[model samples]
Target: MPEATWTYLMDMDGVLVHEEHLIPGADELLAELTGTGTPFLVLTNNSIYTPRDLRARLLRTGLDVPEESIWTSALATAKFLDDQRPGGSAFVIGEAGLTTALHEVGYILTDRDPDYVVLGETRTYSFTSITRAIRLIEQGARFIATNPDATGPSREGSLPATGSVAALIQQASGHAPYFVGKPNPLMMRSALNRLGAHSETTLMIGDRMDTDVRSGLEAGLKTILVMTGISAADTAEHFPYRPSRVIDSVAALVGSTDKPFG
Candidate 1:
């Protein structure tokens, strides 16, 4: 609010929208940030769709988030692998989002003793694919998952996500996966780096305490918990770590005088 001194890294699903519906005042918050030339990114753990795909979806929902402002777990996972093992091969169990990211990094997608067994978000989690991933991991492939989100929100209801499938693979293969999404500070750090924003001067807005708030805290960014999504205000106290600020929604921050997390 105070001349956009603090940059922002916000969660996409909960903070901005929920299951294809734009949250109240979400568009105004983005508009305000863009109008003031505030550096910001809309981050999401869902790796099922590419940035272009997501931007199209958001536009259909009446939230005009820029394609460049969107960052997905697929991109982060690709970046992580590139940094760790450049041009490495992976046996990916995901959709176009994950496969495309890996390809952009010059990584090969194969099942022939791949360097990593990459897991990501998908609507349909095939048992055959999970079995293949488990077998690959058992044969000494490192397990890498996009996120640890056990459940995903949908118009119908909650659906099993990457984390739930990751758990099953871990149980079978006896190998834990390195998650590259929310709740992991690395993801937050990557977003900060992309924005050229220092952690001390950035604020993270999210609705989930376990993923967004926790990751922001660990990444040394001030976190604000909004009650427009998954984590209710009452549930915030249940977590050991707390957000720097708690508000009813992003609507409250629109044109407010308070300069939070500066």
Candidate 2:
């Protein structure tokens, strides 16, 4: 095993790139570690893109990650729903990214009395849609959400993410959903399994305290919080919890030779 036998779980957006533009040193850093056969995976909450889609996009951007190295909330949600209802139809409120993943995994997407209603971050979220999903839940449909992140990264500022939509639905339906993204043990389990990572030798890094950071801490892995993403500089000001290591960006982790064996 390598000195840093630690498997690193990296978040996709903000941490790796903003939109389609790659961060300055992200590609090089990724290449170096991958060349050394260091184990790592891109654990993303964006259910908009498939593993194969993301793999090819990353390759074009100069990072050579394979399909297995990319895990998304879409995949986790699909797996969870597959276990709950095989070939089930889901009423969705997200992007094509999520619907594509569900479709690929054998889920039948529908809105006519669906078996489950999966909500996500959709630019087109509205009262009508929320009411429809809420009605379905009230009528005994299972509820699922991609992630509970309330805010997302954007040039203008933080926009309402899945959390906002989820909160609304939960408010109306009087029932919380089964979230399948960060901080959820199911996602952590799937990620670790795919990476062949042991909690004793893995690191989870991200920018959100409630989701990414909290999830990493819960997974019994060393956690690093970076300021390059959603969490601002003074984010920890009112917070009691802190990550194991605080860095300005993923660049700080680029070539650190420290292993996680301790």
Candidate 3:
């Protein structure tokens, strides 16, 4: 094997783009990874869109990410649920992405006392659905959430996301959900398994220390914290664990040199 044989698991929102805008050098970095025949996947905690849907969105931002190269918490949640109980059913509170993933995994979507109450990100969460979820959980269905992100960035402002909704349901049902997204090493491990990569030679890049960095560290991958998104330079210092490197953006990782990182 090569001396620096490395694969990558990069966060999507902050590391590569912000909202609909591609961060500077993101394209170049992607090109470098593609050209080097490096195996990598763009990981996102957002379960709002499927990989095919997200690929189109990235294309609009001038990034050509293949659908197969994208991994979402929706996919991870489906895999997790499948591993736990194959061909089971769930009462889903999400959009097309989450529902599609579960369907692909042969999971039944229903509201009739299902195996799990799967919560995920949506443009607008309904109060009625949340009430139903609380009732289901109280009636003995296990609670599962796609991610723990309380709020999501939007054009207007931050909007309540899956975690926020999960909290409300938990408040009513008196049971915390098992969050399957970032900060949970299970998601990272699943991504690594998808890539057939070992943590010893993998890198995790993201902007958030709480989620990205924490998850990567727990997964035993070298972590890089960029400042283009949520976590700032000073914010890293407050975390109990530090990233392997702190850079301004993915731009610092664009070059093809085998010097670990540019």
Estimate TM-scores for all models: 0.95, 0.86, 0.97
The order by descending lDDT is 3, 1, 2
What lDDT does each candidate get? 0.91, 0.81, 0.92
Candidate 2 C-alpha lDDT tens digits along 159-228: 8889888988898889899899988967887788877789877888787777777888888877877887
Q: Give the residue spans of candidate 3 off by over 4 A.
A: none
Best by TM-score: 3
- Residues 1-262 of candidate 1 have per-residue lDDT tens digits of 5554788899988788887789999999888888878888999999999999999999987888888899899999999999999989999999999999899999999999999999998897888889999999999999999999998877788899999999999999999999999999999999988888899888899998999999999999999999888887598889898999999888888885237633
Q: Across residues 1-262, which tens digit of lDDT does each residue of candidate 3 receive?
A: 6586689899999888898899999999898888888999999998989999999999999999999999999999999999999999999999899999999999999999799999999887888999999999999999999999999887899899888888888888999999999999999999999999999989899999999999999999999999999987798989789999998888888775245455
| Winning model by lDDT | 3
Lowest lDDT block of 10, candidate 3: 253-262
